[model samples]
Target: MSAVFEAMIRFGLRLAGSQFPVFIFPLLVFIVFRWRAMFSSVRENPAARLLLSYLLVVFVLRFVLYMSGYPYQGRYFHPITILTVFPIAGGLLLIGRYIEKFKRGNLLAWLVLAVVAASAGKVLNPPDPKKWLKDIPDAIRANAPADGRRTELISVVEDRRLPFYAKSGYHLLMPIFGDMFRDAEIFLADGASETGKKLKGKGASPLDLEGRKGGIKLIVRFDEPTKLRAIAFLWSLTPDKMKADVSFQTVEGGDFLKAELVSSNQEGVVFRQELTAKNIIIAIDVKSNSLWHLSTVRGHGFDSYQVFTQGYYNGMMKWLPEEDFKFGLQSVTQAADEWGGDNVFILFDATIPEVEKALEERRLRGKIMPVGEFTTHKGKPLSLYRGIAPDRRD
Candidate 1:
C-alpha cells in the first residue's frame, strides 16, 4: 500500500515537473511556517475557507481517483493549479518578507529584476526542441487547405501530436501502427490466421485447441531449419484444468527435449532454448478432466512482429491509446481497401515497397504529391504524401 501511494506521488510529481515550473522550496517553506496562520485566516474569512476546502477536496479527490486505478495525465492537474493561485501569491509574499528581513533594503527589488531577466532568457535564447515531429503539424496546416471538405486521414507516424496540433475540420484515423507494421521474413502460423478474425486459428492450425479435453499436440514447421531462441504460447484453461504438462520435441515422433521454462501462468507458457530445427512438436497433457484452449503461438527466431502480434492477442496494449480504436486491426492493404475518401493523408514513413504497392493498387499513387519530407530521429526519411482519389475516366 505504501509503495503504491509512493509510486502515485512520484508519477504525479514527475508529470507536474514536465508540464510546469516547480517552486518546491518556496511552497515547502510556506507550509512549514504559515500553515497554522493559513487555517486561522480561513476560519476568519468564509470565502477563503470555502475556497481552501474546495481546493483540498478536489485535489485530494483527483489523487484518490488516480490511486483507485484511473489513468491520469499532467493536464488533469490544471484545475488544482488554478485553485492554488491565491496560495501561490501568499507564498511569494512570504518569501518577499523573508528577503526584506534578511537584507533590509534593495534585496526584493534586485530579486524581482533577476526574475524578470531570467524570464526574458526564454525569448532571447530559446532551447532547441528534442522532438523530430514538432514541426509536422505546422507543415501539415501550411500545405493541407482547410476548405471545409470532410477529410479523412490515416496516420502511421505513431505520434498523436499531429492530430492535436493540426487545424480542425479533418478527421484523423490512426490504425494499429507500431512494431506490427515492420516486415518480417517469417511469421509463424500466418496460414492459420483467419481472415478478418482476431486470435482465431482455423483448419489444421496449431493455435486452435478450442473445446479440447485431455492432451493436445501441436506441430510448428518453419520454411527451413532456423536457429531458435524462444517459443511462447497463449492459452486459457478451465479452472479445473489449471495445470498442463508441456514439452517440446524437435524430431518427428521422437523424445521430448527438456527446455528451460521462461514463463508459465493462466495466460500462457513460454520456453527458451537454443536449437536449429525445421519443425517443433508441442505436447500438452492436462492434469484434470476439463477443456483447454490455445489462442496464439510465437517463436523468436522469426519476425518479432509475430511475437508482438501474439502479445497483442494476449491483451497487450500494442494498439495506441491502450483502449479500443473503434476500428478493426488492419494492414496497409486492408486500410486502403476500406478507405472511401477523395483525398488521403499518409503521415508516416510510407516509402517502403509494400506500402507503395498498396497505394499503387488503389490508384492512389498515380496522383500522389509530397506534402512534407523530414528526417526521423533515426536518420531515416519520414515522408508525408497526399493521394488524390482515382478518377473514373482512366
Candidate 2:
C-alpha cells in the first residue's frame, strides 16, 4: 500500500514537470494561492457556493477514483479535468458579466479564441505511422494454403503487420523486432559488431531464469559432430552481471568446458570456447535481480550462416539504401529460424557480395529461391528471393 502511494507521488511529480495545458496553468496557480480571496463571493451568493461545490467535487471524486488501485498513467488520469472545467466555465461567464460593466469582455473572448486556435493544429494532425511491409500481406493471402497453414515473414518492423493483417483463420509467424533495430542501426551506421563474428547454429532467445542462479541454458544440436568454436550470447543491453558456463554433450560422452569471455559491452557478450558436442547444452549463470533482454543466442563454427531480416529502411523513412541489408538479413534470419518461422521473402542490393555470389552459383537453392529483380529508387540493383522448402520443425 505504501509502495503504491509512493509510486503515485512519483507519477504526480513527473507529470507536474511537464506543466501542460499551457493556457490553464496561470489560472490554476492563482486559484491555488489565493483561493479564499478569489472565491469570496461564495459567502454572500448561492450561485457562487454551488459553483465552488461543483469544482471541489470533481477533484474529490477523482482522488477517490485514482486511489482505488488502478494503473495510473498519463493516458488514464488528468482527463477528469474535463468535469472540473464546467464550474470554471460558469465562474468565467459570471466574471465576464462583471467585466462587461467595464468594456473588457470582447478582449477576453478574443483571447480565448486565439488560445483555441493555437492548440487546434496539433489536435487535428496527430502523429501515427504505418508499417513498411506493403504487398507482402496481400501476397501471403493470395498464395498461402487455405488449410490454415502458417507462413513466416522476414520483416522486422514493430506493427506485427504480417501477423495482424492476415485474415483470422490464416496463421503468420513474424520476427519480434524489439530494439533489435538498434543492432541493425549499429551495424549499418558504424559497423561495430564483433569484427570476426561468424554465424553458427541459430537458437532461441535467451530465457529469463526469473532471478534463478541456476543458469541460462541453450541446446545446440547438429547432424554430425561439429566442433563448437565460438558461441555468441546475444544480450539485452546490460549482461555483465551474468557469467558464462559452456558445456558439451555427445552420444559417447559429455563434459563441461570453461568458456573464455571474448568481450563484453552493452550490445551483447561474446564468449569463445574450444569443445566438441554433437548435442550440447551451454548455460549462462545470471546474477540475481537483473533483467536481461535476450534477443538471440547462437553458436558459431561454420563459415557463414543465413541471416533473415527486412532489407533496409526503404519505404516510409526511406533514408538509407542497401544500408541495413547485411545486418537485417543475417540477424533476423537467425531469430526467425529459432522461433519456428521460415522467411518467404528476401530482398537485397548489390552491397552483399557473398549473397550475390551465392545467387550466381545457385548455392542457396535448397534453402531459398530467387524470385524477382528491380532497381531501388536511388538506382541500386535490388534482387528478391523467397525461402524454399524451409524446415519449420521443432
Candidate 3:
C-alpha cells in the first residue's frame, strides 16, 4: 500500500514536467466532457461515477507530480508546482460536472487557460540542480584552512544528474584520481574499469603500483610534514541501499592485510591508516553488485579515466557544511601530525573558491595544487583540487 502511494506520487511529479501539463489538461477536459453521457448514465446514482472520476483525478494529479521531477518521498519540494497544481486539478474536476452543460468551445478555452496558467507558474520557478551541485565545491573551498602545511585535506564529488545505471559504475574513478597526488598519500573508491585502465596505461608518474589486482596503487612523494583528513562527497543521491568501505593495506610483495575501515555510508566507506613504507596500498570498496563489473586489474602511472566520482572544492561544501568541514580537515591533520609529518597532501576539487580562500588565508599557497578535472556521473567536468604536505619538512 505504501509502495502504491509512493508510485502514485512519483507518477504525478513525472507528469508535471514542463511539456506535460499542456498536453494533459486538454485531454483531461475532453475526457470529462466527451464522456459526460457515459458519466451521466448513473448521475442519479452518482456513487460509481464519482468513484471512477475521483480515481481519474488522482491519476492525473500523480502524473503532474511525476513530470515535475518530484520523486515519491523526495526530500525537496518545488512549492509552485505542488501548491498551484493540486488546487487547479481539484477545481477543474469539480467544474467538469458543471461545464458539461456549456458549449464545447467554452470548455476548451477554459482548459487552454488552465494550461497556460500552470505553465506560467512552473516557468517562473525552475529547479537548479546544477546550482546545487556547484555549491558543494564552493563550500569546501571556503572553509579550507590557510595553513596548508599544517591542515589536512579531503575532497568530495556530488553529481546527481547521472543515468540510473551509470550512477553505481562511476564511483570506480575515485582510486584512479587518488593515484595522481604525489605529495601526500591518497586513497579512492571508484567503480569504473575504464578509468582504471586509463590510469594504468598513461604512465603519468605518481601512481606506481605493480603486481596488484584491481589496478590499485599508491603514490608517495616527499613534502612538509602535516596532518591528514578524509572527505566523502557522493554523486549517488539514492543512499537507501548503499555501502562504502575504505581499507588500508600493508603491501608485502603482493598480498594485503586489512588495516582499517575509515568511513562507511549508504554511498561508500572510507578508512585511514598510517603508511610507514614505500610499498603500501589503500583500497576503497563500494559494496554493490551493480558496481563490481567496473573493477580494474592492472596499475599504471598517469592516464585519463572516466571520473565516476571526482573531487571538487565547491561540491564538497554542499555535502559538508563549514563545521563538518573543519572537523574532517582536523581529522586528517591530527593523524598526519601524530605520525610525524609537517605537511599532508589534501585531495579536493578546485572549483570551490572557498577552499582556495582557506588555503590562502593559512598561507599554504605553495602546498596547494590543482590536479585535473573530473567528470560527474552525468559526464560534466569538475575541477580537481589537491593540497600537498609531507611530515618531515614543515
Candidate 4:
C-alpha cells in the first residue's frame, strides 16, 4: 500500500518482462495441483496465503486506479513483485518438483536461461543520481539547523527514497508529481490540452477558446480572496515589442475589472497592481504578432507557502511556478528557523533560470549560487541554487 513498496515492485517487473512471469504463475499453479504433494499445504499455510493476498490487493487497487483514468504510469506494476515474492518462491519450488518428476532433459534449464536473458533485455533503466541532488540532503543536514525537527525537505526529483531515507533527519515532502490533475485546469490559457483539438489548421493564433475572443486568456480563481504579495513570471517574447493587459473578475460579475498593463523592459519584468483578488483573469491582447513562453509564477501566502506549476508544455520544454526563488532563499536565511523551516529545493540538469532576477524582483536582495556540484554516471553535471542572505523582503 505504501508508495515505496509499490515503486520497488514496478522496478522488479520492469527488470523482467511480464510475459514469462505472467505465464509462469498460472503454469506453476497448474503444475502444483497435478503434483499435490509439491507444497500442497501452501494454500493453507498462513505465510503463503498472506503474501498471495497482498499480491491480489495491490493488483485490484492498481486496476481500479488506472480504470478511473489516472495517468497510466508503469510504476504501479512494482508492488506486485514484492507481494508475490513468497508465493512465487514456493510455487517455483513446487514447479521444480514437477519438472524433476515429468521431464528428464535440459528443457527446464534452457527455459530459465531464456527468461533471465529476456529480463535483462527488457528491463527499464532508472537514471543515476546526480551529484548535487544526492549530496544536498546530507550537506544541508551537515549544516543542519540546531533543532532540525520540523523542517520539511522539498525536492523536484521524483526519486522514491525521499521521506524513507529522510526518516532519521529532515521530513521530506513528496515531489511535484507530473501527471497530478486539477479540476480547474480545464481553463488554463494556451495549454496544449485545451487547444490541441481546436488548433486543426495552420494559422490558429487568432482562434477563440472557451469564451475568450482572440489571443490567450489566462485565468486563475481562488475560492476565497487572497493577497498575492508577489508574482514572478518566467516568460519570453518572440517580437521586439510586446504588451499585455491584465484584468480581473469578481464573484459578482458585471464588468471585467482592469488590473495592470505590463510590458517587458530593461528593469526586468514589471507590473504595478495589487494582485489580491478572489479571481484574477489575464485576457491578453498581444500586439506585434508575438509568441510568448510562460515559464513560472510564484504566489506567496501563509497556507499556500509554495506553489510551483509547469504552466504549459508545448511538446518540448516545461515551465515553472515562481515559488522556489523565495523558498530557496529561505533555505539559507531561515536555515535555523525554529518551527516549520521554510526552504524549497528543486532539481535541474543545466541550472535554475532567473534565480537572481527573481530575488531582485521580489526585492529580496541576494545572490543565487550553486551549493553542490557533481556529475552523474552518464557524465551529466547538476547543482542546486538558492538565494543566499543579505536577502530580506522589501
Candidate 5:
C-alpha cells in the first residue's frame, strides 16, 4: 500500500511536470469542487470516456504491480505518460469552456499557450550534460602519449563512461579495486566448482549462493608470492548472518597463517595492509536461509599498476586485473586530496573551475601540464592533463 502510494505520487509529479504543466493542480482542485459538472462533461463525450478508461486501467495495473513489490522507475512511467495525454487535453478543454463562461476565455487560452511554449523549449534545448563529462573520453584519447608506451590513467572526474574507453594501450585503474585478484585462481574445497571457475579470469561473473547452507572453503592461489596493498570481497546481494575466516600463506608450501580480518559485514569484507602471500584462504559459513550473491574478489599489489579514481560506478564488473604496466602510487591520498601522477594522464570536466583549482593546490608532488582540450556535445569544455612527477619536473 505504501509502495503504491509512492508510485502514484511519483507518477503524479512526472505527469504534472510534463503533460499538465502550469494548470494541473488548479484544474484538479476545480474538478474536486465541481466534480458533477466535470463528470457530466466527460460522460457526454464518448472519446473522453474511452481515453479516461484507458488511463485508469493503466494506473490500476501499475498500482497492482507496485503493491506486489515490483520496481517502479523512469521506464515504467513512460507508458503512463502516453496514456495521460488524451485525458489532459480533455481536462484543458473543459477548463477552457468554464473560463469562457466567466468571460476570461482569452486569458485561459493564453495560459495554455504559455505552458505549451515552455514545454517546447524544454524539448528543443534539453538540459546540458553534467559539467561536459561526455567529452572526457575523447579528451583522454587525444592527449595520450604518441610513442606507444603503456599509459596508466586514473580519472577522478565523476564519469562512469570513462572506464569503457580504456582500450588498446590505455589502462584504467580504480584504487578501490585492487589489481592482483585477476591473476589469482579460485578453488572450492572439494575441487573447482562450476560456479568457482566462472570467477577465475577477466570479466568474472558473480557467484549465486542463494539457498545453500553450511561451511564453504575457497582458496585463492597466485603463481607466486604477491604483495598485497588491498583486498576486497564485493557482494551484489549480501547474505544474512555471515562470517568469513581469512588466512594467508606467505611462502610456497608454507603453513597458512591467520590474517586479521579488517572489516566484515553483509555487504562484504575488506583487508587493507602490506603483506606478501601466495595463497589466500577464505572460509565462510552462512547461517541465514536467504538469497545473496558474491560478486568478485579484488586486490592491488606491487605487481599491478597503481592509480586511484574517485569516479567508478558501483555496479561495474571489477574482475579485470590491471595489465602489467608501469605506474606507482607515491602516497595514500584522500578523495579530496589533489591528484598527482608521473607521466600519468588525468581527464576531468573543465567546466567546473573548482576542479582545476583543487587539482593544482593539493596535488601530491606534481604539476599539471595541459595535454588536450575538447568541447562537449553541448559545448561545455573538457580538459586532459599530465602530471609531471618530481623528478620529471625541472
Candidate 6:
C-alpha cells in the first residue's frame, strides 16, 4: 500500500508538471465542493455538514501551519492547495441553489468573482523563499576576477584585508622608485649582519657594505632602466639622518663595479650626475637635512595632548601611560587649579601610565569617564576617557 501511494504521488507531480492546466485542478475541485455546500440548507443533512466541517478544519490547519514557519517541501503548493479547498467548499454549498435560480447566467458571474478574489489573496500574501539560493549565485558572479586572469605576484608592506587573489604570496615591494614594483625576491634582515645570509639562498648578488651596523639593509633588482631612474629618485629623497646609503652599480666583465649615486652635491650646490662607479662614493657626504626636518616638523604636534589618572588608563583612555599624561598636562596646563573641571575627553588605548600621573599633579581638571571594551588591530582591549575642560564655552 505504501509503495502504491508513493507511485500515485509521483504520477500526480509528473502530471502537474506536464500539463500546466492541472496547476488549477485543486482550485477547481474547491469551487465545485463550495458551491454544493452553499446551496444546501443548514439543517438539510447532518452527515454532509459534518464532512464539510472536517474539510474546513483541515484547510485552516494547513494555512496556519504554512504561515507559522512550518517547513514545507514543495514550495507554495501546500498553501495554495489549502486556500483553494476553502473557496471550493464554500462554492459547493452555494452553486446548486444558484444554478436553480439563474442557471447558465450565474456561472459567468461567479467565475469572474472567484478569479478576482483569488488574485487579491495572492497579492496580499506572498511566499518568501530562503535567501541563500539567490545570494550565492550573485556573489559568485560578482567576485569573479576581471577576464578570469590572475596576477603572478603581489607585494605589500603590511597585510591589509585585500581580495583573495592578492594575498596568495605577498612580495614586499619598497616605494623607493617613482612607482612601486614587486621584486621576484625579498631580503629579510636581522639587524645588518645576517642580511647577506638571507640573500645567500637566492641567486641574486649580495650587496657589499663598508661597515655592519644596527640598521637593516635590503636590495632589490629592476630589469628596466626606467625602474632604476625611479629608484634613484627615491634614494635622493630618503632622509639623510637615517644614514641609509643607496647607490647603483654597473656590471663589469665578470663582476660588478662600485656603486654610484644618481645625483651629487658640492658645497651646498646640487648637481645631477649620471650614475657611474667612479663618482658614486663622492656624493656620500651629502646631507638629507631637509627631509629629516620635514619629518620632525610633521610629527611635532603629536605630543601636544596629555592624559592623567590610573583610573582613566584602566578605563577607556588606557593607551596613554600615566607618566606621559603628567608630562603633557604639565607642558600645556597653565595652573594646577585647571584640573578640577570636566571639559576634556582624553582618548587613549589601555597600557599607559603617564596619563594617570598628570591627573594626580593637578595639571588637568575634569571628571574622568573611563571607557573600556574596545579592540585594537592586534586584538588588544583598551579604554577611553571623556570629559570637557572647565573653561570651555558651549
Best by lDDT: 5
The parts of candidate 2 lying over 4 Å away from their true place are 1-10, 13-20, 23-27, 37-73, 78-103, 131-161, 166-366, 369-394
What's the lDDT for residue 148 in model 5?
52
| Model 5, residue pairs in steric clash | 178-299, 178-300, 179-299
Task: Give the winner by TM-score: 2 or 4.
Answer: 2
User: All candidates' lDDT scores?
Assistant: 0.42, 0.37, 0.35, 0.37, 0.42, 0.34
Instruction: Quote the positional error of residue 169 for candidate 5 in Å.
Output: 7.9
Note the clash tally of each candidate.
Answer: 0, 6, 75, 6, 3, 64
lDDT of 6 by residue, 22-81 (tens): 225544655556555544743597765765676668645544443222233454454445
What's each prediction's TM-score? 0.46, 0.38, 0.26, 0.36, 0.43, 0.18
TM-score of 4: 0.36
- Candidate 5 positional error at 16, Å: 5.6
Across 1-394, the per-residue lDDT of candidate 2 in tens digits comes to 4534654575566445533364355445446654776567788878768766775675455444444322245544445455445444544445556567878448658645655676687578765432224444555555444445565544222235544564412211122222222222110001233222221211211111111122223322222223232133232121334434423232222442222232223322222111111011222111110101122222111123223333334233211222232333444344434433334454443334545565446443234444545443345454444554444332
lDDT string for model 3 (1-394, tens) is: 4434654664555545533445456445555664664456547667646655765676566544443322244322334344345434544655654676765546745665776797788878886455534443443344344554232223333233221212111222223323223223233223343123222211211222321233232222213221121122111111223223333332222222112122233322111111111112122111111111111221211121222322443343111122221232343333334432323223343344544565466555444455444444455444544433453234
lDDT of 4 at 197: 31
TM-score of model 3 vs. true structure: 0.26
Residue 256 displacement (Å), model 3: 16
In candidate 3, clashing pairs total 75
Put down candidate 1 lDDT per residue, 46-74, tens digits, no spaces: 98788888887877777665543333576
Worst 10 residues of 5 by lDDT: 284-293
lDDT of 4 by residue, 1-394 (tens): 5434554465445435543454467355755564464345557678755665676788777755533323356656668655545445556555666687887776556656665676676565544545544466565455333555432443334343543344322222121211121111213344344323322112222222222323333333323222131111211111223244433332322332111223223321222111211012121211111111011122221112222433454453333333343344343334323223223333333333443454466554433345555455566544444322233322
Error of 6 at 8 (Å): 32
- On a 0 to 100 scale, what is the lDDT of residue 333 in model 5? 25
Q: Which stretches in model 3 have alpha-carbon errors above 4 Å?
A: 1-29, 36-114, 132-155, 158-384, 387-394
Tens digit per residue, CA lDDT, model 5, 257-369:
21122122223222111110111112110111000111112223212224432233345533232233334333222211233344356554453354445545555333456
